[model samples]
Target chain A: MLDSFYVAWRYLAFHKARTATLVACVTLLAALPLALQVLLEASERQLRARAEATPLLLGAKGSALDLVMNALYFADAMPAPISMAAQDQVDASALALPIPLYVRFQARGFPIVGTTLDYFDFRGLEIARGRPLAMLGEALVGAEVAARLGLTPGDGLLSSPETVFDLAGVYPLKLRVVGVLAPSRSPDDRAVFVDVKTAWVVEGLVHGHADLGRRADDSVIIEQTEGNTIASAKLAQYTEITEANIASFHFHGDPAGYPLNAVIVVAQDAKSGTLLRGRYLNGESPHQLVLPGAVIDGLLADVFRIKRVLDAVIGVVGLATLLALALVFTLSVRLRQREIHTLFRIGCSRFTIARLLGAEMAIIATASAGLCGAALTAVHASSDELVRRLFFG
Target chain B: MIRIEALEFSYPDASLKLRVKSFQIATGEKLALIGPSGSGKTTLLNLVAGILLPQRGRIQCQDVEVSSLGDRQRRDFRIRSIGFVFQDFQLIEYLHVLDNILHPYRITGALRLTPQVRERARTLAAQMGMGDKLHRPVDRLSHGEQQRVAICRALLPSPALVLADEATGNLDPCNKGLILDLLFASVADQGATLLAVTHDHDLLPRFDRVVDIAEGQSRS
Candidate 1:
């Protein structure tokens, strides 16, 4: 066998370009499916884990997929926002802990989420630096947001306006960066957090004033400050709220009508989750209660269906590559027929010829497999980033 | 130490038949085989080496019945006892000069490549003026150098018989004479028998006897 290997090594070495091309083809075929499977499995695990962590979600009667995506991933699904009254109702249920989520704004391409301190505690997010949301208009940035935006405590970010043309619908609010959360390795790390009321402020449901009628100097502020204070172009929007003016931040409209995109409910137990789902089961009700896990499972079922097709495609490609390898080896042997005959005349047996060809193939296959294994490991290691770019982006 | 009687061999799918009525060589005789292009000089050599079995004949080389051994046994006997120098000096192109010489030892267990054998191969290469070319790939060598490497390989195992089929065919006149000198000197020093096929008649006088295979006949 060793003698056969020595001869095999010589043949392959002499034909460097052919051997290299064959090995590269094998590596590509091996890595394609291995990388795909590793990334898909990692994304599935991440999605399932996030869904399982959030027990239930309450939202307007609409696409449950959209509601779950909005709540769990802050995906721009634009499911109709449920009223704050619904969130108050869940809070009053005493069956579960309610955390209101309102996400309709962006800052520097990152979603700005408006929720309460309970949101952080519920998600087990720890403040890596600075303090939590200490007051309205203050913000807590996720680790990735802080790192990517270079925002530290006391830094400020302006929300992206809903429309650059329609200044009446909502004015972009300026938020103070009060804290940065530790790495969560999830979608949460890519979001900005604030008290839900701050989101209302951005929506024109809330406002701040030294007074709308009088400027801080006690003079008529502007000529357009009569009908709607937030819509008034001359009604100076507070770009920065310091301690002196922070006390004046307050909501103008009926607070009960404020919008919440979805309410995440943490059940006291599985029984409480069942009872909550049961109470929201009235078919005529405009709200729907759902388990985030079931919703994600439905999403993954569709993904897995696509995966099956992908796997089949890979299987066919693998078979084709295997055929190509056999063809290459056959042609190689035919090309070396004269050499084979010479070996025979030199007293080498037929077994040695077979072993020579077999050893060359074994070496190429083993090396290709090793390269594929390394590629799979790299995909596994960077899968979190892949998921973010694929789904969240 | 070789004999052939009533030998009849023909290639598969060919009409030409090689029939040798009688032939014999002493244990250490240097015999030259001369013939035209279509003559069976190489065929006769192949038969003597047991590479091709005679359909109806008796070939005796030392103790082995060359015409009757099985396929595997014949191969073993060839590697252990007979060395062939092909007409084309068929050195494996992928191997270096040294490994080409050691190929028989690698391919079969009939001859163990002892350290002493390796040393002897180096000494033989040095004598053939190929000692410095041992590590060079055989394909990169000049025609004369390649022919010398082929002769070195044939003598590496110190076989009982050395068969040459136009062994010096690719060399110039000067290198041809030099190669012939090397071949004769090596065979004489090892006490090995030599049977060579040649188209060049100028060097025919060096052989102890010459066989003309015009119709597969002999004249000594």
Candidate 2:
């Protein structure tokens, strides 16, 4: 038996290309389904943990999935905007503590999250390198954003414009990066968080420009009427907020009427959360109150359903590949007929010939198994990052 | 060393048949069986090696009845007492020169491949002028060198009888003489009998006896 293996090893080693191709095919056939399962399990853990941590969500009457994805994950899809009065209503009900979110902009490729300081406490985020957000327009960058853009305390981050050609539309705001949050290993790691007022400034809802009362530059005036001076399109507006120009910035409309994307409601108790849900069930409310955990569970159900179909497809392909491998072995035996004849002429028994072929197959299978094991170990280690990038990107 | 009496055999898939009335080879004798193509020269060689069973005959090699032995017993007897050298050399392409020489030991448990056997193989390769190329693949060797390797493999077991089926037919005239000399020298050194089959008439004079295998080596 040992001599059989020795001869078999020589035969396989002599055919380098055929041996390598066989190993690669068998390894991939075994590793694909296993890697997919690892990633899906990781995705489930990631999606559910974030959702179950928050009790309820309040947003404009629309897709609860979209609202949860945006408010909790800061996803690119912006749900229909609700007014700030929704957050006020949640607060007035005395049932939950509502954290307002105005996530409607981007800085570079990362999402710019406009939220209150209460969100930091709710998510258990802490400053790692700089101070917290204390004043308007001061930005606290996430750990991943800071590392990717090489940002540190006292640096500046400019909000991205919605469009370069939106000349009369939203203006880009320059925010001061006062701190960098520690790595939370969640969606917050990839965000740039700021006070909601800074986001409104980026929206051109409230802005500050040159004072019209002092007509120091008459040439900039488009029209002057009784007791008021109208400015032209070239009026010098403050893009970066500083101590000198902070007082000049002001809001134009009622604070309750401002646009908000969603509100994360943390109820004081289970009864309060249930009552909040009951309020939205009345059918006359403009906003929808959702339990985020239930929304994620439904999403996972659909994912698992699709997973079943994928599993079936992979099974068929695997079976086909196994059949092809068997055919290859059969053809190889046929091709080696002359060699077999020589062995028989030299007095090799039938059982000995079969043992030689079996040894060759055992070596190939062992090599493929080793390669598959290494590949699975690598996928298992990186499943978390893979899920975050695949599902939430 | 070999005797056949009233042998009759035919392949199951083919209509070709072979018959031998009576034949005998003396111990330590070198005999050559000569015939045209399609004659039963190589079939007689296989019968003497116990690779094919006779339908109605008895073949005795060194007092052992090779014809009456079962399939497994014939295989065992053949490996223990007979060595074969083919015209094509039949060397496995994937193995190196030394590995090709030692292949017979690996195919059967009846041949115990020990350290002494390995050393003898190396010494035999050295004598064949292939010591420097022992690790070279057989496919990379010349026709003459490959035949030399086959001769080394057949003579390694020092069998009592060596079967050569057109061993020198594939070589050139110069290589033919040299290969026949090497084979004759090895058989003489081991005091073994040799039964070589060939169609080449020029090399018949070197054997001790010659038989024309028309219809068969032995006839009624």
Candidate 3:
């Protein structure tokens, strides 16, 4: 048997071109599915880990996938915004601690997340360089964002439009980079964190300007005026920080009108989570509450269904590959009929000849599988950035 | 030793049959079967090699009935006792010359070649002028060199009998002489019997016995 195997190895090695072609076909066939499986598994693991960290998500009623992508991954825009009043309502409840997230802009292609310091604490994100987002318009860059954008503390980044453009479009505000987070290997690593007020300001929900063309003394006097009413003729198009008109620059609409993208809730316990979900679904609350893990699971279930179809296709292709191999072997046997006859003439039994052929196939398949497996492992080990670039982009 | 008693065979669509009655070759003797084309010389060799079973009567190799054995047993028996060299120089083209010569041993699990057997193969190859070409692939060799490799393979395991079906049929005059000399010399070294089927009348005198197969009869 060993001798037969050696003979088979020699036969495959003798025709290096045919053997290499077959091996390459088999290797690619094997590697594609293995790589896809590994990537899907890794993405699911990361999503699940993120979901498990947050107990529940609160947002305006919309597609559950969209809500999850917005709240958990910060990858997409929130179609509707929940109110800060809703956050206050949730915070007043004994069931949960509402963490408001206001996201509506991008910085260098990474999402700008406007939330309080509790968001970082809840997600267990650590500061790698400088401090966390401390003041308005000041930001902490995620590790990936910092590395990719070459950002550091004391550097500044202009907020890109919600809908990015090919050319350098209008920049609403410049965010001062105050800190960089350590590599968390989480979604946070791809986001820029700022105060929710700053996010609202950047979204044009709030505006501030200096009163131009007024003498400095007059401007200071107008800024100190205490009335809500501003004389339309005297009010400059832009207002500055002064004791009088600074009050006029304050938010004019009802506080409820300032909407939040979403609120992440950390429940006191599992019981509170159930209660909180029940309160939101009670048909009275305008907002929708969801378990991020459950929503992500549902999304993954849909993805897995598609993966199943892909797997079926891969299975059929694999079968076809085997059939192709068989066809090649059959054609090979036919082409080598004279050689087989020669073996028989040289005192080789039919069984030995067959074993020799089988050994040749087994050797090629085993070596190809090994090579493909090694390639898959290497890809998997270095897949994080590759997958992010391919899919998240 | 080989014995054939009233052997009869025909192709599946044949309207006529080829027949052989009472043919035998003694141990250690070189016998030649000479005939015109379509005289059933190759068919007789196939029957003796157990590649085909006779439809009538029996073939006995060393007193064991060849036709009576099952397919597996017959395969083993052929591998252990009989060697064949085809006129086409049927050396497996993918194998090197040395590996082709060692093919029979690879099959029979009889890789143990005594120094004498190895020396005999090398000496026979040298006589055939193929000793320098052992490591080369058979496909790269000339038709004559391939024939010499086939002969060396046939004689590798020192089988009790070597069957050649028009072994030198495709060779040039000089190659034919070298192949015949090597064939006879190798068989003599192993003290193995030779049953060669050929159409070349000039080669007949080299054999210890000459049997002509024509019109389904052996005329000695």
All candidates' lDDT scores? 0.86, 0.90, 0.79
* Predicted complex 1: CAPRI docking category: medium
In candidate 1, what are the lDDT values of residues A196-223, reduced to their tens digit? 9888777767776556545544333434
What's the DockQ for every one of the candidates?
0.67, 0.82, 0.46
Ranked by lDDT, the better of candidates 1 and 3 is 1
Instruction: Locate the minimum summed-lDDT window of 10 residues in model 2 chain A.
Output: A210-219
Ranking by lDDT: 2, 1, 3
The fraction of correct interface contacts reproduced by each prediction comes to: 0.70, 0.85, 0.72
- lDDT string for model 3 (A1-393, tens) is 877887888888889999998898788889888888988888788778878777888988877667777777886646587789889988899688889987778877888898999988888889999887766678899998999999999898878775556333333577888899999987789999988877776675555554444535443343435454343334343212223433434454776668788899889988998888888787766678888888878877977898899999999999999899889989998988877876765556777888888898788889889989899888888677665554344
* Candidate 2: tens digits of C-alpha lDDT, residues B1-220: 7888999988897666888889899999999998878778888899999988878999999999998898988998888889899999999998999999999999999899999999999998898888999999999999989999999999898888999999998999999999999899989988999999988889989999888878444221
In CAPRI terms, where does candidate 2 land? Answer: high
Q: How high is the lDDT of residue B156 in model 3?
A: 69
Clashes of 1: 0
Best by DockQ: 2
